[model samples]
Structures are given as structure tokens and as C-alpha cells.
Target: MISVLFFVLLGAMLGAALGYASQVFKVESNPLVEQIEALMPGGQCGQCGEAGCRQAAEAMVRGALSPAGCPLGGANLTQQVAELLGVSVTIADADIQWVATIDESLCSGCGRCYKACPFDAIVGATKQMHTVIRDVCTGCKLCTQVCPQQCLTTVALPPDSRSWFWPKPQTAAA
Candidate 1:
């Protein structure tokens, strides 16, 4: 009975010491890392090549990863992350956004593409020809999959003066 009591006391003392040590040595996390993690899609899909969103955010804060590194978040998230990190990202390299284009000649106008488009980029009547709003299309290709006539095709939007960025000059490695 005495030995059991002694061991229980010893265990409790050790547990208390460990808990106190943990509290004393606790490291505060960066708020920026938290903000970046919250901006992620929270899929934990590992598509970004990180173990999880938290690790990815830490990497972003440390400059080990690019602000636009998360593939699932796409261009909008990339822009938000870039803005939060105070970094500039070129649209061509960062996103390479595509837009859906409907071939009027081949379209059967069955309304399948219109229904499948999540962005509401297609506009037309049920039986009439549909036109894709290039500005609103995310190029997800859902419309292409649902198109009965296979008329919806995704095309890389040509970079205009606004979307284009000047190439950064290469520096000599002195």
C-alpha cells in the first residue's frame, strides 16, 4: 500500500513538472502564418507539396514557398496571398488563367454547358446559342464535360497590356 502511494505521488509530480515546462517553454506562433493558413482551402490535399496548410503557411512566411504555391486556391487566392505578403506576382507565371470559348458553329444549344458552368459565365436561352463571358470564366472545364455538342473549349486568354508583365532582368552571380 505504501509503495503504491509513493509511485502515484511520484507520477503526479512528474506530470505536473512536464505540464509546467510545456507552459513555460511554449513558443508563440506568427499571426501572419495563421492568416495565411486561414486563407487556404483547408482541403489538406497535399497538392501544394506541403504536409498540410499550416506547414505551407509557415513556409510562405519564411519565404521558402511562393505566395501562389497552393494549386487548389487558384488565381484569386494567389492574388490575396500576394497582397497579404506584400509581394508582386506576375499573372502569366502565377496563374496562366484560361477562359472557356463556345464554338457557335458546333453548338447544339442544349443548355447542358450553361447548367454545368459554376461561374455563370454562359448566357443564352435554353434552345438558343450560348456565349461564354470570358471575363467571368475560370476555365474549370465543367462546361466542356457537360456539353452535349462538345462545343465548349478552354483557351488560354491572350495577355493584354494590363495582364502582361515585363520580364525581370537577370542579375550576374558575382
Candidate 2:
């Protein structure tokens, strides 16, 4: 009974403290905006064809940007982002980035391209010939920058994996 009483007192004290702190440090919640913002491809690549993630965020909240804005986050990320913001979404076609395809037979084990990849998506040992993992590949054309032999080649989506969406219509004809 004594222990229970002590716990009750402690709980009451903590609750009071929390309530007081809340009044002192209140923050407005922008749940609707932040949720959609999180879905933006973190790459900040602007390749989403948007200016930046935050720009995309503003557009999303205003319902100006489509799920199509972010190329890296692609469909899955866009869908969740749209749901959270209570906005409509039209998923863009899958854009498989043209990642480097390592030709093992031609591989020199030079590790040159490995140095060029900023995303750390390539895997291999030094002087032991590196390999590209397509799933993680950003297809930035950076790795191809370092290859002296020019083995790495970018391939357009082979059509099997390609999908389509209504292109953002031109508002003003030039």
C-alpha cells in the first residue's frame, strides 16, 4: 500500500511536469505537410524533375506537384506520401536508372569506376574487379566518368519494365 501510494504521487508529479512543459514549449503540428514531404526522393536530385525536395514538399501540400515529380522515390514512395497528405496521386512510369553494367570478361579489376560512384552503390574489392548491383544503382553516369576502358554503358529501359503516365501537359505553348 505504501509503495502504491509513492508510485501514485510520482505519476501525478510527472504528469504535472509534462503539462507545464507543454505550455512552455508548444509547437504547431503540420502533419499534413510533413507527411507528403517525407515521401520526396531524398536525393534532392531535382531529377524528380522538381527544383528540390522542399520545393516538391510545398507543391505537394498545395497539390501542385504530382507523385511524378520524384524520379528516385518513384511509385512506392509517392503512393505513401500522397496517402499521408490526403492528396490524389498518379504514379509515374518506372524509370530504371541506366546503371553501369559490368562486363566481367572485360573487367580489369582497376576499381576506377568505384571511386566515381557518389552513392556507394557499387560493390567490389580493390584490384579485384568491381561489380554493379542494378537495384541500388543510381545510373548517374558518374561511374562511367572514371572508366578508362569505357566498359560501363548506359542502356535505356528494355521496354519490358517500362510503364507510362500522362505527361505533365504544357500549360503555355511557345
Candidate 3:
């Protein structure tokens, strides 16, 4: 009975100590990282050399990366990130937006492009002409590189009503 009582006391003491430690040493996520990530395009594209936008945000907060690290986000996003991080940085030149177009005449329907696309943008059956869902394509060019017939080509996406956005309001010249 005494041994049982001692064990119960020891367990309770350890539990209390752990609970106190957890409260005292609670780790908090950096708000800067969250802000940086929120400003990003959330493309999950690795053009920034990071795994995803969240990772890039973390790197930027940790000073391991620059605000212009995201190629997909472009100048506007860089500017936003810079402002959030309280750093002055030159806006990166925007990259041309490309959309995958499959030439039905050249497509062999081997399904290579379908499998290569990370976004599931390509739709078709084996031995049938494959079509690219333009709306879903991120234009990472992963499909173009994997097409054995070179049927997949990236075309510059023209701005449509959906792509258009109002320009940011400029501040008064000092």
C-alpha cells in the first residue's frame, strides 16, 4: 500500500511539473512568418527554391531569404512582403504567365503530361487526345518537359476579365 501511494505521488508530481514546464516554456509562432505567408500567392511553386510559400515565409522571417524570393508572386507580392517585414526591397520583375496548350495533332495520348502535372491540369484517357484545363494550370512547365511528342507547349496567358486587377493606389509624392 505504501509503494502504491508513493508511485501515485511521484506520477502526480511529474505530471504537475510537466504541466508547469509546458506553460513556462510555451513556444509561440512568429507573427512575422504568418504575415509574410499571408502576403504570398500560395502557389506552392518551388521557383523560390523553398518547398512552399509557408517555408519561404519562414525563411524570410529568419533572414535566410529575401522578399523577392517568390517568382510566381512577382513585384506586387514582393512589395507587399517587404512592407510587412519592415524592409525596403526592390520589386522583382514579373514573370510572363504561361498556360499549357496541347496540340491535339501532335499529342500521342501517352499520358506522360497528365502524370507529370502536379496540379492535375491535364485530362484525357490513355491512347486519346489529352486536353489541358487552362483554368487549373499553374504553368509550372512540368508538363512540357515530360511530353515525349513535344505536344505540350506553354503559351503566354493573355489577361482576361478574371485575371485583371485594379492597380494599387499610389501614395502622394513626398
Number of the top lDDT candidate: 3
RMSD value for candidate 1: 10.4
Please provide, for model 1 over 1-174, each residue's C-alpha lDDT reduced to its tens digit, 9 standing for 90 to 100: 999999999999999999999999999999999999998867554657899889999999899999878765666677788999999986446456678899999987799888877568899988798999876766667788888777888887776664455566779999
TM-score of each: 0.53, 0.51, 0.65
TM-score of 3: 0.65
Q: Count the backbone clashes (under 3 Å) in each candidate.
A: 0, 1, 0
Residues 89-164 of candidate 2 have per-residue lDDT tens digits of: 6554555545568777777878888877756767887778788887677666767868887878766544333223
Error of 2 at 33 (Å): 5.2
Mind giving the per-residue lDDT tens digits that candidate 3 earns over 30-147?
A: 9988888887767576778999889999999888998878766655677788888889985323445678999999888999899888778899999998998988887788788988
How many Å off is the CA of 103 in candidate 3? 0.9
**Stretches of candidate 1 exceeding 4 Å from the true structure:** 1-66, 69-80, 86-95
Better by lDDT, candidate 2 or 1 = 1
- Cα deviation of 130 in candidate 1 (Å)? 0.5
Model 3 residue 114 CA deviation in Å: 2.6
Error of 3 at 19 (Å): 11
Worst ten-residue run, lDDT, model 2?
157-166
Cα lDDT of model 1 overall?
0.80
On the 0 to 100 scale, the lDDT of residue 38 in model 1 is 94
